[model samples]
Target: MASSSSSSSSLNFTVRRCEPELVPPAIPTPHEVKLLSDIDDQDGLRFHVPMVQIYRKKESMAEKDPVQVIRQALSQTLVFYYPFAGRLREGPHRKLMVDCTGEGVMFIEADADVTLDQFGDSLQPPFPCYQELQYEVPGSQEITNTPLLLVQVTRLKCGGFFLAIRLNHTMCDGPGYQQFLSAWAEMARGATKPSIAPVWRRELLMARDPPRITCNHREYEQVPDTVKGTVTPNQDDMVQRSFFFGPLDIAALRRLIPQHLRHCTTFDLITACLWRCRTKALQIEADEDVRMMCVVNARGQFNSPLPVGYYGNGFAYPAAVTTAGKLCGKPFGYAVELINKVKGEMTEEYLQSVADLMVMKGRCLFTTVRSCIVSHLARFNIREVDFGWGEGVYAGVAQAGGGSFPGISFFCSAKNGKGEEGIVFPICLPAAAMERFSQEFNHMLRNKNQPQTTSATLIMSNL
Candidate 1:
């Protein structure tokens, strides 16, 4: 057994490939957990956000004979996460991949980052990294999970080690993921009783082999790209940056919008305001077209309910529109109008398009949809995703930016009262353009006529 042990403690960890003999008899995927709950499927409605926490160990965690113990624990845990072991195969769901194996899912990757810890470097950050092969684990030396996750750990030029964790959206949301990670951490610490033993019943999430096409599904589907333009590899055209916006800024923006304008939500204010800034930066023509695509959840959108364990891909992209000139010229309220109007279209029709398109070509449409130019507004409550360690310092969306989308941004709530909400965005314009864009954004915040800024910026450094 191959294992790495931390020098300061008796606890050691072993990393090994999952073998069939170690797996337990499989169960069906859970497709139904509940018919319906009070969870609202609306624009401002909040969902659990997923996160990967990194811990640095000053002392070595490698053990001489820890492989067996780690393997035993992995075996037990494997039975619970069997669905992941299944491979992605050819099916109506193009997002999934399946080789010769009847099953179609597997763990993406997990590794160590010693160099990050020893050198005392800050968390490197969210970047474009992925492994082409589905089942193999990636090391720090290579990019892994292009659209998924990439974790790198190296023995820094200094002493300690870094631990990086990558998680895919399909697996679980933030709250659900935190629960799973907490349990794993406990197990790693040698806790006798796991906090939340996983409930692995595939039937809870399994759909009919052919799947039933209903209005709900139809509303979420989009035309697969196989029939559309081909996607050439995108060169790096943008710079990814992490910006912090505080409470005062958000509050001011809220104040700018008229009370009659529904008091202007966070997303509403930011989208409208940024569209103004982007127009200035890119110098888009007044009559030129621009649209903001806000993602909507369809999990409980239907009149009928779904199972609690019904965790497959369950989201749709809806577009909000504005003319570059109008968006730039309008008062904050006018921008808010675009956000509200566009958000309203996240109906059954939009969702069905996504589903209908996927099943038509089976596997050809998945990559096509991912390559399109679309800006997404991901709004969520970051505080709720607490593990045993407590709530997170910051929470924000991580995506593969650059040539993929010229304009993409994410909004996350500020942790505690630290002030500004987090913004994860990619700026693909030239230096002068980026400078102009930043100026316009600041002007909106400082302008007493605009809505108030929410919190203070925490970490505004570029990625």
Candidate 2:
């Protein structure tokens, strides 16, 4: 039945035998490591919300041999399963292994008429299709009884189709995901095999036994009062949407920030600008405390170290700071300064603080940290998620649009420098606030001294 969808052309693909890579040889980190049994404590600390969108021109040949294209595509895309290495003890249950079920990829169907505009329309402004998948997960979890890949098909008025790929972020970062896709595309194009094989053994990242928490870990964990929250923003309080910021504009803004502030790199500059924009958009009070959260990959942060191919969640949260009033009034350059100062806090002491708190306080720490925070920016490598269709225009998470205090956001880039140059940021804020925020954001991009295009806009809605 699946084959019937494809044309009779030479194009053909299939999900043959694919297995997870062998665990790499590496020392294990003992003291700081959490066994599968201890994972409950890290529950919400990590979320698996990775997804991709593929755009392809419609062709008569494709329709004639739907399966051919799909199969070819599937063949090109590589898939694998990473099993939980450590044993989990729960009462009588001796050893329970955790694997990302064979379901790690999904396909969404859409026709040509569903331009990015319409897709955005369907999502409804701030709320975008990308963000709606969270609701789809629980239902999927019920259907598959585990984290599974999801695919959707939609017929558009035009001939082309849009494919949305959803995967559990826990499995891989954007780059890793792209590598798998590129391999699949090659296969779909009739390649005998993928260009590069995937690496999955967690042993590669295992730290020396008796893992020692490095001091740098402490700096990234510290945060502020007003920025922290007791409860994370719920669905009612937040919506989701995707926004594009052209690279040229970002580059222009980058030139504007003082030299002292630019040293921290891309994340610092973009985030600092955003902090200023969000503050201006919301017209936040100068005295009110505001914070911006950034994801820190913990793979190499610890003193002991982690195993290579450690495919589990290895991320930490650090933040930039500002008062509502200060952020709103400052020039973009000043915001960069704030961003630099706060990021400096991510030091060994901070890591230790977080480790001690986690070990001493246990699960409660996760909650304390999650609540006392507002907005999260995970700069995971997005450009790497390439399926056979070449590189992606952009890849990343959509924000939960309309929200109360402490908004959460995500940033990623396109496969190539094709679509937008800078990061694809999904922001969620109130309508009134975003309008104002958009203005300042544009102004920063179009500074006469360093002018840039205003390609990104906030289409507020309840997708």
Best by lDDT: 2
Across 109-217, the per-residue lDDT of candidate 2 in tens digits comes to 3222234434432322232333322224234432123433444433333333334454544344444454555555565556665555454443333332454554433
Candidate models: Cα lDDT each: 0.41, 0.44
Best by TM-score: 2
Q: Give all candidate RMSDs, comma-separated.
A: 9.3, 8.9
- Residue 323 error, candidate 2, Å: 3.5
Estimate the lDDT of model 2: 0.44
Q: What shift in Å separates residue 347 of candidate 1 from its native position after superposition?
A: 3.5
Name the regions of candidate 1 deviating beyond 4 angstroms: 1-51, 55-78, 91-163, 167-237, 360-389, 395-406, 414-430, 448-463
- Model 2, C-alpha of 262: deviation from truth (Å): 4.8
